[model samples]
Target: MTLRATIVRPDARIVVQFSCGAASAVAGKLALAQYGATHDVQFLNAFLASEDADNRRFLADCEIWTGRQFTVLRDEKYGADVQNVFLRERYLKGPHGAPCSKLLKRRLLDAWKKPGDVMVLGYTAEEADRLEDFRERNPDRPVIAPLIERGLGKEDCKAIILRAGIVLPYMYRAGYSNANCPGCPKGGEAYWRAVRVDFPEVFEARCQVQDELGPGSWFLRYRSGPRKGERFPLRELPYGPIRRNESLPSCSFFCEMAEADIIHKEPTA
Candidate 1:
């Protein structure tokens, strides 16, 4: 008598997009490393914003980890278009008005996606809602959530990165939260507060966008909170000049929102 083992090979090509965050980027890097080591895989740098030192660091880390050259796709042009008012009003409205994600992330992904290729998203099981949302939106794309499949939450992913000896992005350390952008519209009041305190220049730029686009424009409606409330008073908060320090606030975006001022006072006419 004889026994035999069968190896099942994946049908679709695997590609992980690096977004430059503690959890997502690390997860993507790990996936790239693992798949590249055992099977054929491709890595992509779908950078939607300007190249910064932090972005370079993530790329370098990916190179070191995967021992392979990663392909870079420039999507900064798409990100810039979202800054335009006409485009925002004409195409995106209400919940979709902020086109940052669509322009910066989604468009790039669409351009790179192949019919049979599997897109590996960094969403974890803890973010079930987001995972479901991604699946719903990209029904034809066949998205794969390896982090969720592995039962690794954000903290676990962070621990993996730390254990791997790769430092997280400076924005994460500065307490601005998500590494998407320094002043992402998805950020909450405390996120803005942290921005105002830690990255004054970026905060000022965001305020300028608000001033130009009018209030309640740049940030996500829920995350922005009420129009009348000030999570951190603009007058009292730090602004203009930038400063840097090694230590970061203990809490990141997830925990910081709770401490923010959430109430909105009625506007006086």
Candidate 2:
């Protein structure tokens, strides 16, 4: 989607991209508090089929906590299926990014968004750089980061949710930090090993996708050794203990840095 500034609407909408994560849930509450009186604040969640089913339960709980309904959207082309994107796009992780994000989340949001619409993202103060990167990349897109502005981080968001009497998504309770896809391509070997244990079906399904897409769809790369920087197949990934504290940032619009620890390149178009 080619982005350009549009003439401001007299009654512009405040569109909060709610990703069913703690930060976005709190961001929605904050946005409603700050702009519900003056602006038409709406929550939008681009539902991903690969995300933990508990995310849907969390979404409903968050709606009650925020006292607002969410307009959940699905990818028209891929039906919000991460595996479908990987198969059709014939790619997964790359210097650009995983196609699942571009097809399922980004494009869905772009289609629903309009120029002059104020976008409230879930970026926290700790993720200020990601917010800036998003702004630099899409200068025309007006954004309001309530969490960052409030100086809240992931832990703070979690606390706020609990204080509201809302249960965190099962993904968090299951020891996964972010409520992302069960077998998120951004995860490293250790993370995948955890998936192998927790969500064996998802791990096996992703391995099947790799088999279909060939080597290009591999999601892991060796960090140090003779084969460093080479893509590693998930099926061959060795089993290992997962760090209980291994936390990956929740993936959302403008938070592509989830892959920063692994790959660095210009943002995907």
Candidate 3:
């Protein structure tokens, strides 16, 4: 079915994109507190098949905590698989962004968005550049980055989620910072190394795909290190410490919001 066909309610003007991460859960709570009484707030998630099973558990807990049903959206086109798109388009992630993300989420969000609806995203204070980039790029999407606005950090979000009685996702327990898909295509040497220890089968599958994609097509591209711009396949990735401790910045519906912002900013025909 098309994305527009999945809209049971076409008029939810206040929408929250729940990434099923700690900060996202907390952001949804804050949005509900601010706007639920005055507007019909809707919570939406663009589903990813590669995500851990415990992400569902976290989603369930957030539903209970927020007292609202979270809508799970899928890209009917790609069926939410990055590999499927990679194989079909003969391309994996590029320097600009992930094709899987654009086809699945960014496009879906565009089709699902209603005119004048407010989009709530979970971006923490540390991601000031991303927040600025988003705002600078999309000046008319009626978007709100609550965590950034409040100067809340990752730990603050975790504390709020725990106080509300929601257990963190299993990925967190396993020392993963962001609850992105297993073996996220954008991961680095440190990230893939951690994935090898945490999920071997996933690591193997990613390696196989990298081999299939040839030497130039790789998941990560290093900028400053010895290997700069060269495709660093997961197969050769050495075991190392995970990136920047166990703390990572909040996950955003990055491309989707950017697309919406740009489209809405255009002069209407």
State each model's CA lDDT, in order. Answer: 0.53, 0.79, 0.72
The TM-score obtained by model 3 is 0.83
After TM-score superposition, the amount by which residue 239's alpha carbon in candidate 2 deviates from its true location, in angstroms, is 3.5
Error of 2 at 47 (Å): 1.9
Model 3 pairs whose backbones collide: none
In angstroms, how far off is 118's CA in candidate 3? 1.1
Could you give candidate 3's per-residue lDDT for residues 107-212 as a string of tens digits? 7777787787777778777765676677678665567667776778888998898888778888777767768777666666676677788788987877777778
lDDT of 3: 0.72
TM-score of 2: 0.87
Q: Give the residue spans of candidate 3 off by over 4 A.
A: 1-12, 221-229, 244-251, 259-269
lDDT of 1 by residue, 65-157 (tens): 657677776655555433442234432223322345555555565677676775556666576565564454444445556677677887787
Count of backbone clashes for each model? 0, 0, 0
What stretches of model 2 exceed 4 Å from their correct place?
Answer: 1-10, 244-249, 256-269
Model 2, residue 154: C-alpha shift (Å): 0.6
What is the lDDT, from 0 to 100, of the residue 172 in candidate 2? 85
